[model samples]
Target: MLQPRDELPSVLYSAAQVRDLDARLIAAGTAGFELMQRAAQAAWRALRRRWPQSTRVDVLAGSGNNAGDGYLLAALAQKAGWTVRVLAVGDPQRLAGDARLAFEAAQAAGVAVLPWAARTSLQGVLVDALLGTGLSGEVHSPYREAIEAINASRLPVLALDVPSGLCADSGRVLGCAVRAELTVTFIGLKLGLFSGDGPTLVGDLVFDDLRADPAILAGVPVKARRLTAAGLQALPPRQRDAHKGDFGRLLVIGGDSGTGGAALLAAQSALRCGAGLVSAATREVHVGAFLARCPELMVRGLASANQVLPLVEAADVLVVGPGLGQSAWGRSLLSVAASRSDKRQVWDADALNLLAAGVVQAPAGLVLTPHPGEAARLLGCSGAQVQADRPQAALSLAQKFAACVVLKGAGSLIATPEGELALCDHGHPAMAGAGLGDVLAGIIGALLAQGMSAQAAAHLAVWLHARAGERLGSQGRGIAASDLIAPVRELLEEHSPCLD
Candidate 1:
């Protein structure tokens, strides 16, 4: 049986892994049909609780175990006096094993079973069971048509155990995926639910263990983890006797000429994130603006990489590439920063592009923050490719550069050189503006300066950044890059307080 919860579980597994876990549970004495029945009961309870007033259900079932779950759910609804109809998209006669038993049960329960037609009129809540985590590649006919109908119906929908046509391993939509109002998943939480397109289409995710024994699941390693503030153990509070020198020195290099605002945003973010000392090496014209905007920053005008050497040598941590153009000046600054191996580095924006172009190399303690476009360049693939499997792209970047990688977008992911991944399901659509990446770079730099490992810094910075965006996203759009700074600072303090 699945337990009710306000939030999803932290651990995640691929579709194949979840299936294997199911088999393992069955092998461990839990009968396959018993698990299916439990899943149906759990999903039925969840559906009734969520849509209590709706006594009508339209279940779209296939011929697999996914369909079996749906058939059982329909049976439960029918027995409970709900007007339930099981629309068989695939031939019901082809159902075998537990799925066959489920169909028989639904029939015995007197649930209205009908073959789905392209022009089928839908009523009440929609149950999407056309496909499950077993699907990959493009969605084929009838199933595709069914998914389209479910999406186009404009009715509230509940998908059973991973939305039909959604790749459970990558979160990629197979041609098209069902957009459900709620998804009741069984056994293990699918990684796809928190990666790629999963979060957007999954709506509210509910998980049930199906009463799988803890010992049965003890040996399977998780595919990834969902990063949250509650899961992160923040830094210890600052000592009462702490001084300016107790923190860290952070240097930001960018602002080639016209885009000084990007570099400035990074510097401002670093200061706000608690860097003891923050400096900027940008165009001379931008120096006055930096001073006026943040007197705390040690601003220096620089034309070439040589000019930045002095400051780069002095900083404890370096944040490079915000507003850095592809021109020679921007290249020089990155080259100079890349030249040093002594300081930890956070690279973003043009820095990432330049790295992708092979202009500079990432150091040992490097943290690269690249959006889909930049990530595509690094992986030699398209933005769609990067997005289709964000976890793979992020992990590839980390492994390629031997650094921690933050692949930022809807579901931001942080991957380390060792292939460990943490995903942030936070953040808002309002973050689709400029200067945000620069701010994120600075935040990561600040965390690195504060003695956090590159991997830890990237995860913590992403969590804080996304959480801040989510809070501001509720207030409507027009969220500026700088608008995130104070909120992130506040979040950091709330989670990782300065006071003991």
Candidate 2:
């Protein structure tokens, strides 16, 4: 098992795969009961650290290994002279393997084991070992009732592995889930805990490898990696003598009538993020206003795709679909942009809608940024279905479109065509406002223009954009999309600078 203080491994695994790894360890001569004991010890340590003054603990357990961990924890608390009670929701006799052994140990330790009832007064720190990663379908009757009671208690909850009723694979709530104050996860980091509803349900997250052999971890395939500042800061330094033209030009192609702000946001972000030159292709009436707002941008007024084609031909990167409508004019401009095979593309907003309509094909070396609704359109599925399994949906988008895909939502996912995945866990709810996606597209476009590979650029852009939102989110509501431009520039300088 990896140590608590060790740097987190880059690899992420699914629940089933992690279970298989546990089985492999057991088969390799380590007993399953010993692993269970280690998990209990880790949870006990985390619980005590989180709530040192609380001497009373209520352990809610089920029949699985998750329940076993709770049973062991209760026993430990009892031995320490703290009042501990074990509420078993499932028949203890039905527990198999390590779980059965844990129950026996709890009984031998003289901890009070009682049949769980909804009316049970759950006091002190509640240990939720009710469900593990093996849960699939909606949480059933008794467990749901128990979970509801636990939530109603408002006591601090310490989850054994994952919060009961949370799908460890997708982060979707199984009917309903227990909101934990702290969650001690064992073996591998489940991708679900960082995405969708996972972040909210899981409080302060803790991971313990339980001293699993390093060689064993190397054999299992990873599902995704969590984006961290250290990894994103690994961007290559710029050459001292490099000229502006070497960075690359970024052309913003959007801003239909009445939505010029979205287009301006993208152009402004690209300019702030170190694009060599920034230009906006928008409604003729908005050109003067956009130019006045940002004199550094090369604002152009175009009425047709024919007029924009020459501009598209001259640019090194294209950021399309900000405020782009599905009208004929928008379709015409998108077709022109899509026809260009040489330039790298960052497609967002209605450009994604246009692609979903079979309006154009996403060429190689392209990035697609889509929120849940847009992702649903791209996948021919409902938004609920997309959120149900965000990671899978993101990977599917990358594979089907053959482009770097950014599935934007609460826990944004960046997926590469090669099946590598990275999660951005830093954004705030204030980012739910309009034009954020457009800004993100421009940020990625700027990185690509600066010669960062599509994968690297997408990863860096997502992290920076999320961190920027987090930095600005505390400033209160109605945060304008343009507000991100300055902070994004600062972050870009901090990560990758033109002068450095």
Candidate 3:
């Protein structure tokens, strides 16, 4: 059985792993049918709690364990005096094993099992039990029709375990999927529920372990860990004897020509994130505006990479890319940064492009923050391909570059060379604006300079940056990168801090 938050496991599992656990539990003495029954009861309880006044339920059933849970739930509703109808999309006779047993139980309970029609007048709460985590390909036929009907009906839906047609391994929607108002999942938390299309499809999520044995879960491996402020250990408070150089110096290298704002955003974020000192090595043309906007930042106008060597040597960490172009000047500066093995580096935007062009080698302890397109360039694949499997893509980048990789998209995945992966479930659609990645790069660089490990700083910085975007997303679109500084600062204090 799943425990409370305090007792819950830190790891999350895939759908296949959950199924394997079910098989193990059955082999270990617990009946498979009984587990299916428990799952149905959990879903039923959640449904009733969500809509206590509603006495009607329309359950769309498929031919699998997922549908078995729906049949059992319909039976429970029927027994409880609720008007329940089981719209069987797949042939109920084809149900095998525990699923067939559940179907028989529903029939014995007098639940009306009817064939679904295009005009099925579904009212009250909609229960989606069409497909489970077993889905491998796109949804087909009557099941697709049922999902469309459920979505078109404008009725509130409660998905059992996971929303039908949603790939539990990745949050990708298969052909068509049910968008439920609430999804009650079982056994262990699914990584898909927090990434890719998962957030949009699985409304308010609720997990029910279905009474699986704790020892059974120990055998399965987790794909990733969800990042939360609670998981972060507090940084030791700074002593009263701390001085200016006690923190770290961060150098921002970018701001090619017209896009000086990108470099400025990164520099500002570094300063706000607690870098002891901040400097910008940008195009000579943008120097005036850079200093005027952030006079506190040590601005240096540079025409060549040679001018940046001295600043890079003085800095504890380097944040390169941002508005950097693929021009000769940008390449020179990137080469200079790449040559220095002692300083930590954060590569974003054009810097990532340079690396992808094989213009420079990524040093160890480098953090690569690339949006979907940039990541695609690094992997030599299309952006769509990268977004399709963010976790795998991020891990591949980490392994290839031997650096911490942050693949930015709907469900941003952070992967380290050690095989550790973390997913940030926070952030909002409003963060769809430009320059946010540049800001994120600076945040990570600052954290690294402040003495945090490369991996931890990447995870912490991405989470804080995304969460800040989510906080401001409610204010509507056109969220400027500069707007995130204050909220990110507050979030940093709430998570990690060197001072009280």
Candidate 4:
């Protein structure tokens, strides 16, 4: 079993950065082969602990350092009196350096080494040490065939480092990725393991630093960060003399004609998540229902676009486009919201559509929450493009608009204008319903109203919202958007309590 700290590291690194850190450690006095040996021992220990009853193992060894880890692991198993079989998928004749040494050690230990075949028999626990992060293209030829065979084997498997064939930076599959029951990664945690296809493929991931010097890591540049409670800038505890006016007022804009519920949900979420005052600007038809549903909210009927200016002037933060239809009414109101450059704002739904169409422009320092479909429209590319390289797409959106971007989906990514990226890996598939984005927008608005920076508010809000979804998601589907607000509030309090 893994501990809490093993879930993810606070800082994330690219494959190149991790490799550089490895080199740094080697230069710092630890031999490169010594590090490789430590990695093998760590993986061997974890494998044995995870499956203590099994005494027979099969290791799929390729030609890189990753294969070296597998060879050393086979040697360890052989030393432990366990039956060990090494399937040399990569030509062992081409192995060099520490890898060649490991292969020779495995051979000397009496571990049977066989050339990989299409029909290689996998026995006991299977160790996947095939393609490493250096792989840049699709899985081809014998490696692809070997990966397919590994997947075909209905046995428990442990992947060394990242799953073979997974992009170490993007978390995307390269042709095919190995599916493992448990994965033990050495040194730094790759960003790919937390996003895209990573969570499903690398189950129960654990990290071993290979005992690299802490001083060496401090000098390395991190590519991104995984948002966690400890890394956030918390909302301060309220004063004993706190009043409603202490927190900033937020306005929820949208709900054209028949879509009043979206605006109401946004407004309610803002109120629940700690906005001092919440106001809703929606169709005249929904005002009475809004008052009855959330009496604390100051709901106004916006019959004309002109009415939005008054609400805009009163709000400290504006959350736009929750059930906003693309009718003239919505466009008129969005125009008013977009024209102003003074207020902190969050744009979603129809507002995003308008921005994509070039019908409206965002004021400076705004937040954009777009799902893949909306993101494609914004980026002028296919949805597949955004999903294929989510990190790049999110950074592109942030840089293009000079605003904070929350590219929402599996492994939601938060990118800021300064080029910093944060990943939220807490959400569940059951939260994949309508209106969740509306709730998320409102929550973000509430945090901004409370005076969090665009980056801080976005990173924290995404984490809180995803956590709420995860908590309720296990109830098994049909998770309503409203179900998340209360838990989100509770979570926020725990993260940064109101009374300290």
Candidate 5:
């Protein structure tokens, strides 16, 4: 539910990638310590801008280059006539090279350097440089206590680079992580800063490239890209003489009994998103309700799987599994839909559950949208494990099924079988409601029906859905799945006008 900010770089690097980039920058004539000084300078300027009234600074320093940045910041603060304190969580004696030089600089500036203890009192705008992107294991010892104490203090904090104990690659917290009010990141933007627990804990994020040579950066492989307006491919402008048949037919299959609402949301979303022909195939029990709710839909009620074949045959894209119960009725329709391998498909809800249960093989030309739990079931692992490294889990699922996978939640991620990955950091907390997935599936199906490839459709749909939720979420709670349709339609038109 974090707010979306101005556009950042599309490419996101792993911690290893950032480290390599740093090394290359140093080897390419930028001294390592000089880069460290620039990082401190960037952080100092950001801190001053964010809290100009606060004149005191407390820097929690650890060993390694992370601490080097902290020590340098403490030096800068002291020189600026601010009361500065450096709580050394890791032994400063262990510091070497640039880190040692930074510590000496801090001492020369008369910054109060103290060995951290459980009872140490923190003041002013706290700086978390105790741990950086290199931390992959659980936080241990004094660092864990230090992080806990920082969180307990509830003081405004500015974290240098990645927050202490936050996995820079996955956005997962290692045991405990510092909750900073502002984070100043150096070099390339880390994928973790926008995904998982990152948005919640990192607070306001500010990125500085540290003036790394663009050519040196281009040589490093990017792990993923953030979804942005400029990067989105718009739907082709409608011709002066247009017909509904010009788009594509999209069939929404689901809504067993009491869950007909879910399927209705999907159908409604597709209709709003400009599908040529939108149809809903559900149990006979829900047919009247579906038609009543969305009169534009071509609604058909069925008692068995035999009734779905004709609809599946006509659809250019199929959105399956919204409100699809695990009963025989749901399975029968899913089986029939699964058989239509040539039709582009978007599978969600029970469809994903059924696929995980081995009841139906995934179809060709497919997009699977699953939340963390559903993704875990699809990958044969626990939800926690999947969430631990969402990027890898998403990639694994895509490779296993040879389909485009949209792993939805906090920072929704889209991955393809070819190992391409993209992340969407646009959304709001009010979006935490039921039937949203169904709406999302329909949006994707509508995009596919409009002739977009699965990857492109997913990227656009995910971004649009999240952005719509974000806009509506600003009004505060009570956001229904149906509520997102109009906004989504409006957003689509804005992104791609009908005439031009």
Candidate 6:
């Protein structure tokens, strides 16, 4: 289950920004050591709550302030009469200032401080304080080995701040990061904790401001805003005298030979999400199937690019490229769709591919939904490169195309050309299926047609799609693309009811 949004701040920060926030607090008269003590206390309370019956804790310590936190936590456990040991992975002698003081306090409190070795026995619930947010380069030497050991232990682990070996800035694992089951982070929430490998490595997260002044925290710049169900901008309640034409017309353009289901899914999703009129333009062979499945959509079979011109002109919003194969038939339809600068469009799948290939240029008022591979192609980089810095990649795409870009993956990032960014971390692994992107494209299109701005539509659509998938995903895998539409519609009503 996802953590409650009320417990977390909406704003997300970079590692550097968090450090600045810490510095600001210290400058305001709160001692640095006091903040460290608060972090330890917060972590201890969370640990005890999670494992009330467990009494033993092994602290994996480094040489940084992160190690100090571990030492203080060890002291707390020792005073509580629980078996506690601090395995000093990073040489304890190198520790200085507050870290040294923390170590001395632990030793004075009768906490066992032992040098870490290859054959060190890892027992009970482990506390990972091996590395902090300052980590940049790939982890090397004993630290990597220690992180490996922690993962191998398979015991319930609690990571202080960011997980060891995980990039607090990018969420990329440096060599191998500690996979903690519970992570208690301090001060500002890091962006890496929500994107890339951060979500998978850092398990159930707990955030504490460490009692920093709210005005001080607000002064520092944030990387992005986290999109929560409660925080999303809702579509206004429909009028009692509303008619079908009250909402704008949305056209779904895609569905090549042997790939009709993709366009149908988008069209169906739009209809379910309250688009006034939804139309689908696909291959002639698939027209009958689309109409049979969803007769509400004005399904038209296209034979050439010219056939789509009229449909493109009529649509207030267009959803392009779902199962839109990289073929002549698909290319012709996308070309026509791209020509409509007046129409707000959600481009996904092969539409992104075509854009990357320079087959056509997308107009303004566009939402480009690209998975990592597609984003890589669009940016002329590898998929690994795109995943390494998802936030930057999303921003780059939005700026390059002057469009709203949804860099979809683990933590789907939504970026606007104006540099506004938002993240949706509400999806489940079970959402890994075909046609999900198509459904998302439709959802965005419907929201856009219903008078939401390009960025607002993309944000609301991504949140709704992911939340719907998360709900259905709980029933286990094998979720079809169509499975999300009803749930999305239901969730939309709950979020923005037809009647106030």
Q: How many backbone clashes does candidate 1 have?
A: 1
lDDT of 4 by residue, 27-107 (tens): 889987888889999989889889989999999989999999999999999999999999989999989998899999999
- Which residue pairs in candidate 3 have backbone atoms (N, alpha carbon, C) closer than 3 angstroms, thus clashing? none
Whole-model lDDT per candidate: 0.90, 0.89, 0.88, 0.91, 0.93, 0.92
35, model 3: CA deviation in Å?
Answer: 1.5
Say which prediction, candidate 3 or candidate 6, comes out ahead on lDDT.
Answer: 6
- In the range 1-500, model 1's lDDT, one tens digit per residue, is 22433166788888888989999998888899999999999888888878888989999998899999999999999989999999999899999999999999999999989999999999999999888887867999989999999999999999999899899988999899999989999999988988888988988877889988888787788889998666786777899888767679999999987999999999999999888899999999899999998898999998677888889888999999998899999988888888888889998999989998998777775898999999999989999999989889999989998989999998899998898998888889999999999999999998888888888888899999998998999998999999999999999999898997
Q: Give the 10-residue window scoring lowest on summed lDDT in candidate 4.
A: 1-10
- Candidate 2 vs 6: which has more lDDT: 6
Please report the TM-score between candidate 5 and the true structure.
0.98
Q: What is the lDDT of residue 101 in candidate 4?
A: 93
- In the predicted model 1, the residue pairs found to clash are 1-211
- Residue 151, model 2, lDDT: 93
Off by over 4 Å in 1: 1-6
Lowest summed lDDT window (length 10), candidate 1: 1-10
Candidate 2 structure quality by residue, lDDT tens digits, 85-154:
9998988989998899899999999999999998888888999999889798999978999999999998
Evaluate model 2: give its lDDT: 0.89
* Per-residue lDDT of model 6, residues 29-99, tens digit only: 99989999999999999999889999999999999999999999999999999999999999999999889
Query: How do all models score by TM-score?
Result: 0.98, 0.96, 0.95, 0.98, 0.98, 0.98
Question: What lDDT tens digits, residue by residue, belong to model 5 across residues 1-500?
Answer: 11236555788999999999999998999999999999999999999999989999999999989999999999999999999999999999999999999999999999999999999999999999998887879999989999999999989999999999999999998999999999999899999998889999999988889998999999999999999988999999999998999999999999988999999999999999999999999878888887777788999998888888989998899999999899999999898888878899999999999999999999665899999999999999999999889999999999999999999999999999999999999999999999899999999999999999999999999999999999999999999889999999999999989986
The reply for model 6, stretches above 4 Å from the true place, is 1-6
Off by over 4 Å in 5: 1-4
